[model samples]
Target: MARYGMQYGPPQRSRVPLVLVAVLGLVLIVILAVGGVLLYQRLDEPDSAPPATKPSTADAVEFRRVLKSEQGQCPSPPSDTVVCDANGFRYTVGRVELNGAHVTEVKAAQNEGDPTWHVMLNLNSEGAEAFTRLTTDLAKKQPPLNQIAIVVGDQVVAAPTVQSAIPGGKVQISSNYTKKTAEELARRITG
Candidate 1:
């Protein structure tokens, strides 16, 4: 009771709060130390190397000899990779080049990093002359020379005469090819 007649409330107790504060501080310090260590290790260590490249695609020549159809169709059509008669022939790319204004032979399914599959023709002088004449005719046609197609096994692959005429009867056929396919095309053209 107060002397002035007002009633006084009971005294409030004070709390220490020391142990709670200490525990909280300790936990904070521990978390920070752990975080710093992980960050430092990530930054300091050398980078782990990337995984090596797997041979997802096989060599064109090798694929041709050993290619098989997932569905086992025969006399496979000349598209992408086709297998027929229990054998597979990969239609790889072929390249042609001119040799003294004449085509020599086409280079077939070469591996990556290989020089482009260069094709040269052995067009007899007469053949060379014929090719040149035909090319000129195709160039002058109303439809232009884009229709001039190179046919391989019922497949018309490229029709590129847009740049220049195939001098010496030499031309190139590049595609997703295998060695066997390139060889087969070369054989067919030689005949």
Candidate 2:
């Protein structure tokens, strides 16, 4: 006999409800944590933007080829580096004289009412000298040969021809790039 009443086995409390409560609590905590992280990230940058869509497999392959020839297996300093576009058309551009180290700043800008964006590069003294010479030589070439390709990492973002000497050193690459793409180019060049 029990002290207060008839013994009903043991006070069997169903743990199912407790378990459900605990699981719900855990889920809430996880959601809160994730939300907090996302909020912090957004607040931290304020001007943060989403990343652009990645290039296709063909673009990646072509970019890899360009990087390999431009910076990877070069025997000498700056020579003729032959790179192919996504369409497999090859362009034998001058060697990369001014790399990320030579670039001081990179910015993405767009003219009002213009549907396209462009990347601008501010270079150092050494970069300016080498760039001037490269552009000068390219300008003297024929139609398609006049353009100078900007190879960054495994990507060839732009290839525009030099109209004049470009003596001042600030180079603006006009291209059919989107804002995200322009920002990406800026990141690559300012590495």
Candidate 3:
């Protein structure tokens, strides 16, 4: 059996080499640290290169959402135009009454406590009459067929069902429009 400080067979390997190797590694680390400090001190660089900062994941996601949500200004179509919704349904220029002459004003508004927004249009006498008749006829129909579609430049921005005739010259359009969508619709209507 091996006794204290006695090898069983071959002489035990000395740990001096391993200790020396660890010391060298520590020395190398110190040298690297000192060299980095010296180089940094020698270079007249900015305190920080503006950090090379980039948008965080949340910021990037928000930016993409904003980009995607942007709706361009409304289009200007000819006086007599026939536009269609995503479905096969069609809305004549007469029905919409946005002939670039009858719409007095268009405004985007958000309902209180509601995330959804809408566009309000102040119409002229002619437009108001046509719009009222259209809404009255649509109110009697069923489902989507009963909805009065607001078409602009081949796009049906809104198609809301009318339960009763909107008598006033002002018309409020609501189709769960976001703020961007509502603003775009208003711009189109006014234009």
Candidate 4:
């Protein structure tokens, strides 16, 4: 019964410090939540970008077909890049499989800030005949666009026309490209 204004309920251990600490922790949590929300919004915004980003895989069927065509070419260097051998010979992608081939002793980029390189190719009599036939047929057909694509590994390098019959197995390609590029293409085609 020692009653010195002490109420015998639970002891009120100075609530001021505990309340202040709880309020500070709550404020910090709210600030962190708001900052997180703002950061997320910034990252979601869109920005300008170039178009030519990734390689085209096309349709699954087309992909399979292209893969089949490239398998015979060899994956040792991959179709998208160039390959080379010990010899000085440089290979160029042809218009068709075994129809024609681009052959060159050297591949140098056009000087003065140009990205083009010159390439030469050869075709046997059979290849020339095939090229002529395919081109003639294409001329008659109404197509979106037709090109004789040269394939290196699994990538398309160049594809030109027959011009005439290319019977002499000689043709040239003036590619809009660079020096490193020229060497790369040449290596891939020949190697």
For candidate 2, write residues 27-64 as lDDT tens digits: 99999999999999878863433342322221221111
Candidate 1 lowest-lDDT run of ten: 60-69
lDDT scores in order: 0.42, 0.60, 0.56, 0.42
| Best candidate, lDDT | 2
TM-score of each: 0.34, 0.52, 0.47, 0.37
Q: Per-residue CA lDDT of candidate 3, range 114-188, in tens?
A: 888876666678867876776677677676556554555456565666788877777777778788777766655
Clash total of candidate 2: 0
Higher-ranked by lDDT: 2 or 3 = 2
Residues 24-143, model 1: lDDT tens digits: 999999999999999999998643222212212212111111112133333434444332221322223222211222333334434346543422234546556766765665555443
Best of the candidates, TM-score: 2
All candidates in order of TM-score, best leading:
2, 3, 4, 1
Candidate 2 segments whose C-alpha is farther than 4 A from its true place? 1-80
What is candidate 4's CA lDDT for residue 156? 48
TM-score of 3: 0.47
TM-score of 1: 0.34
